[model samples]
Target: MPAQPFTALAIGEAIRRGELDPVALTRQCLTRATDSDAVFISLTEQRALVEAEACAQRQRSGTLRGPLDGVPLAWKDLFDIAGTATTAGGKVLGKTPAERDAEAVRHTAGAGMVCIGKTNLTEIAYSGLGLNPHYGTPHHTPPPTSSEHEHESRNENEPRAPGGSSSGSAVAVAQGIVPAAIGTDTAGSLRVPAAFNGLVSYRPSQARHSRLGVTPLADSLDTIGVIASTLEDCLAIDDTMRGSAPLVRAAAVPEQSVIVLDAGCLDDPRVSRAVGDNLEACASRLKDAGFHIVRRRVASVADTLEAITRHGWLGAAEAYTEYRALLEGPDAEAMDPRVRKRLEAARQMPPDSVVSLYRLRQALKTRLREELAGATLLTPTVAHVAPLLAPLEADPEHFSEVNLATLRLSMVASLLDSPAVALPSGRDDDRQHTSLQLSGPCGEDEALLRVALGASSALTA
Candidate 1:
């Protein structure tokens, strides 16, 4: 591997400078994707080559589309890609080929990004653990020369859980198969996988991007996002998907307030000591870089947890309603038993309770915005690093517990409809990656990204 992996923007610049060939780049990506170990459910070989060829011609003509003109990316299988089926990592759903590209797909294609393939995910994107019974789960083993290998025995290479339901997308980028991949997050799907794999993920406000042509797991909470090698790569893809001009990078505002959620208040035994330590280290870095760090309990966090305990996960209730027929239908047996069980459990949630959860979500969102008061909220993205895959695969009960715990913190941002960025904080003594999440008020996607950029730079520096 190269000392510095190519980012989407770097690839585009190389193409423009005649240092790279779009067609050749696309072919190389396609070749690598062949050995992705189930990372891709299907590859768009013909379409990608055709797009690459056109991009090459445009490059020669000096009429490139944009900064990411010749970059190659993978989409989570949930997005419609014209003739390919949007599998959503299930054998039963999306059996037929789509007739048109999804709205987000069209936007990226319009910006000249090559679509290498559709990546795998949890069935219907329902789990954060990233284990897929139908398609093999995607896992990342760090390179021997990487920091992960420095502190641990070679045994650390054991296959571990790839955070999901965006499992394949995160693995693809982490393995350098693609600079960036698009995925959906309802309850930390994108961020969890990225956190586990030591990458960056951005979950924009739900309404920030068009969800058309995308499969629905939970209508209200389902959000399209990107997982990539860098914050710049994530922001560039975000711009392309939104069909907006690139956002100008700005320096961290002087004395900008960043609220570090007090770990003591969480009182969750599942939160590892390593996660808390890494979060504090990250907070210290930001403080050294001139950001105002405030440590206190955010009332909204506690309130959201209490409300969910009282009512239940709004997304689960919504997902249950979305797939109730499939769960009850004759085809139910064909689905992943784990995913099926989860969706079916929502049946016990009374309809009135579901309604109350929705109402509570709105109230919580309002309270959260006021509490945040323009200061970004920083918390551990997941309570712990990714767990080993064997135990999770062998014990379904263990899987359920870890899955809920892994999604706990990220779910708060989802329930409140806040835009969030998950950054790789640092590796633990065991060489596992820990993640820090920074979220801002709903609809403040740009501001959140800027803060994330500053935080990322501070940590990396």
Candidate 2:
């Protein structure tokens, strides 16, 4: 029989039509995981196969749940999976298992998606660069040339940063180990990796999904997100996560004014010429599609960075709050030094200053909404393509520098509490991927997805 398709929707459709068996599909993905097992902290092999068998039975009974029914996906290790240890990419979590699935995980499973495993992430999901000194970091593995189970003799590409804190989840989809995976975005965890690995990542408005079972980075800024190969897949999987189809408007005229920040935002020295060209080409294509492109200095972007500098980063402050006892206890010695340092910095923040920062953040959000108007904003998801892994592993200082730079643009959307999608922007000189991000007003996720759907063809053209 011919090899089954790789995307979730396609695979689900095949299963629904009896062209593919869910059990067989699950086995194929499990086999793929074997070669890149470093991507996962734990594989729910027995559980997944059992789930797949039931899904296969459901398909035969004409009761497949939905487009995601029987489809296998990986989750970032931060999410609670009943009976599995929720590591949050840290060594200090020990062996305690979660009694119930994360609300996000429950929602996805309820929609009939099978959980193959929990993918690795940056330690505590703290960094944009997907380095995990505790759990092994997952790198970008090239796709199989033939079947989903094809194993190559040798990998010619040098290992590069996977883009974290959703590193493994992004790699799983990018390498075709799975069709799609769930990731979390606090600042730029989802979007940065999507940019580095050539996948589409969606960051919903902060309040769109419940955060009950996922490990917290910053309660106020954290949001559940999905990384997939296409916008449509993201929409489908996002629907499953949200427990209903998004409130997407039909036949809504595409917004014509595409807002762009000044060249300074896109001209970072880390950005490659190819990435710059690809971004320009996407803008030009959108302009040809009748969208009027406008360029300006978005003062809000600057204001966000200033706020972080003045009041200390909310992510750091909140993360410190969540992990204070742990960091202060003896187990703190086991924590990733990089993450420990960040939380320590935030620990020093004055209680009153953190409170004041929240007020400033509220004001900034309102000011940005008015300044941006209805024009959707566009920017490169990261300043550079994924960096070589060796140097980053060897130097903590270098890792911190690159990690912060990788997050510069995507963090803007997070600060504004806006919905954003990062779309692949072709390849850079090293053949590594880069991405362009489309950001819309706060709480307008579906609207942004619709705009992205309309503009996707041009962006990918």
Top-lDDT candidate index: 1
Against the reference, the lDDT scores of all candidates come to: 0.88, 0.81
Task: Give the runs in model 1 whose Cα sits over 4 Å from its true position.
Answer: 1-3, 143-149, 264-267
Candidate 2, residues 76-123, lDDT tens digits: the string is 998889999998998887379999998878888887888999999988
Model 1 error, position 189 (Å): 0.6
Residue-level lDDT of model 1, residues 222-246, one tens digit each, is: 9998999899989888988988756
Residues forming the 10-long window of minimal summed lDDT in candidate 2: 245-254
Local distance difference test, candidate 2: 0.81
